[model samples]
Target: MANVAILELSRNCAKTVEEIVKLERKIFPKHESLASFFHDELKKKNSGLLYLHVDGELAGYVMYSWPSSLYASITKLAVKEQYRGQGHGETLLKAAVEKCRTRKVSRIMLHVDPLRTPAVNLYKKYGFLVDTLIQGYYSSDRDAYRMYRDFDSS
Candidate 1:
């Protein structure tokens, strides 16, 4: 989308889930989409926020939550196929970092699919260091690497 706006997703998040499912399905043939996880997280009323955008006809979405928790989690970050290379991902990440800083979180955490080299590189570029590796993490025959960015709240 030419105009990028960040909205706190409550209802529009349903659409976001759909997009995520579609993307995830491309990689996982039999895996279900994570739309429910997004909905449930919001329903839990925890400290999570999703930033979404309208790109003419497509949707660009990034979700982040738990900024105030001991280990705030970055649940998901996705941009539509046509929206990639548009800097949307970086902008979303910057916003997520700022949100974490505002919450005074000690650390930010996210799990990356080991096979996804691009994602791994992106996290590294963003200064997220590997915390550990979780074997057999994804049911889709994928391993997960846990990464974290330590932000001093002091």
Candidate 2:
């Protein structure tokens, strides 16, 4: 049986950030990756990162930022190829959402490649609805779906 753990990263954890950057490079293209700005992102007051570990090995991570009191954005979610299809993405996402909820944000948002069916389905399962199609959001030839989930604040 695999032992699973989800941890909220602290801003000053350099070793963990290094590991996350390595995983980010493996999971995303250079143009879309957060590797170069990850450390700086963590330094922001409203940003947070949640990482997953399976049997002590890094499996995935989610980065989020609540820039304002009313909304939060999931900036990135990535799972190592070896860990794909094993529910690590969902775990990371759930944690990110819950974190935002605890902050009393009214909505959560993210952008995803429309062609990534599995990711789109996962977001849908979590109640995120597409807000619009972003032209060249990822690149000149790639488009993205801006998705969001609103919480009942009343």
Candidate 3:
């Protein structure tokens, strides 16, 4: 998998709102509208993501939002369910961090469902701090933990 290809997607991929919304639904079953995806919710966030492919097939993806400030945020990170535990998620995350570092981003933050132990553990391994958790952070259906990491400025 050392030769796996990773591509940074352009803003426009011609994907239908329905298909994109379907993917979001997998993560947030109470899924919001696609309108919010490009507007109000992550408006200030300029997405910098990489699609991970192994053996020419989609393995995983990491989507992070670069704000061009001292901090950045990861909007989403997921590996196809069948592909979990193979380190693809970690690889995707490292790619995101590398991209942020290259762009001079010093801090990165992300929200994950508190009950998602595997994800929480993976993030902890990557040095993210448990920043804060709002009781109803995710939605009425789930609670989320906000994790953060700030890198050395030098």
Candidate 4:
């Protein structure tokens, strides 16, 4: 594992959005974040954007939203193609879970393409169970699995 730091991003960090977009393009070319999208998310009180820096370079990011205190939803998770398999993804994910815990969120959930076996496996490793199959969740051609990890905060 490389020396990685998980940093929360904000609108004040002007370059952060560009770096995140570049990493998104490399990992998920089909879905890149627009400048405005990042801008809006940063302005939202309920949203979080965290990036994993390996050796001080942008390596990956995980974005999530907690609409209420009861639940948190992971909106995005991506690791640079070259940096995959180095535990960056897992680190980012666990960090998100902790964020939710701190917020007193009872459940954390995310949607994943069924084809992304590695991601599904990682979620399972963190005790996420398949909650349901969402038809055409991503697109008409793509289906998704709604995974959930419930916490016993009591």
Candidate 5:
């Protein structure tokens, strides 16, 4: 694994949005983030968008929103094809977890396609437990597992 840097994107950073859009297209064509959406999220205080770079090249990104509460929810997590299995995904997730802790969130949650075994395993390894099965989460043909990791076990 290479030394990767994670950056919290800013609204004025055009390059960050461009790179994120490209990576999103490559890694998740069905769920690509538009430039406008990136701009909006970057401008908001309750939302966060983070990108991971290896030697100045964009490798992956993670987006999450707190939505006026102490609950953190992950909107997207993606790594370029070439960067998968190189720990970038886990690194991104760790960063998100830390952010949630910094914001004093009670829990971090995310939805993942049931068929995405690797992602399911990764979340489980980090102490995330399946909360429920959401039918039509992505679409009528797709189902999702709602997973969460709570900071306060009590």
Candidate 6:
């Protein structure tokens, strides 16, 4: 059986941040990746990261920020290719949302590539609804869907 764990990352965690950055580069396009700014992001008071390990191996992670008490945003969520379809993404997402809930945020939002059906489905399953379509949100050739989940409604 696999041992699963979710850990909240702190800014001082240099070694773990490095590992996450490596995984970030592998999962996202260069321009869209947070690798270059991850540490800086963690330095913000309202932002944080949660990473999951399966049997002591990095499986996935989610980065989130609540700039105000009313709203929170999921900045990134990624799972290693080998770990896809194993529910790690959902697990990370649930953690992120719960973190926001603890902050008493009224809503949580995220932007995802519309082309990624599995990701879209996962968010929908978690009660996130499409709020808008942002043209070229990822790149000139790509677009994204801005999705949100309202805590009050659920």
The true-versus-predicted C-alpha distance at residue 37 of model 5, in Å, is: 2.4
The model with the greatest TM-score is 2
Looking at candidate 6, what is the lDDT of residue 154?
Answer: 52
Error of 3 at 5 (Å): 2.2
TM-score for all predictions?
0.79, 0.97, 0.80, 0.92, 0.91, 0.97
Model 1: runs farther than 4 Å from truth? 11-32, 54-58
Q: Against the true structure, candidate 4 has what lDDT?
A: 0.86
TM-score-wise, the better of 1 and 2 is 2
Error of 1 at 13 (Å): 6.9
Candidate 3 vs candidate 5: the TM-score winner is 5
Relative to the unseen true structure, what is the C-alpha lDDT of residue 84 in candidate 5, on a scale of 0 to 100? 90
Spell out the clash pairs found in candidate 3: none
Clashes of 6: 0
Total clashes, candidate 2? Answer: 0
List, residue by residue over 92-124, the lDDT tens digit for candidate 5: 999988987788888889999989999999999
C-alpha RMSD between model 4 and the true structure: 1.8
Q: How far is candidate 3 from the true structure (C-alpha RMSD, Å)?
A: 3.2
Model 5 CA deviation exceeding 4 Å by range: 31-36
Model 3 C-alpha lDDT per residue in residues 1-154, reported as the tens digit of each score: 3567777765565452233345555655555323346434333446665777677666667778777677788877877776789888888888888887777878999988889898999899999989888687666777889999889978
Question: Model 1, residue 23: what's the lDDT?
Answer: 61
lDDT tens per residue, model 2, 41-110 = 9999999999999999888899999999999999999998888998999999999999999989999999
Q: Give the TM-score of candidate 1.
A: 0.79
**lDDT tens digits, residue span 9-75, model 4:** 8668878888887766656536434434767877899988899998889998999999898899998
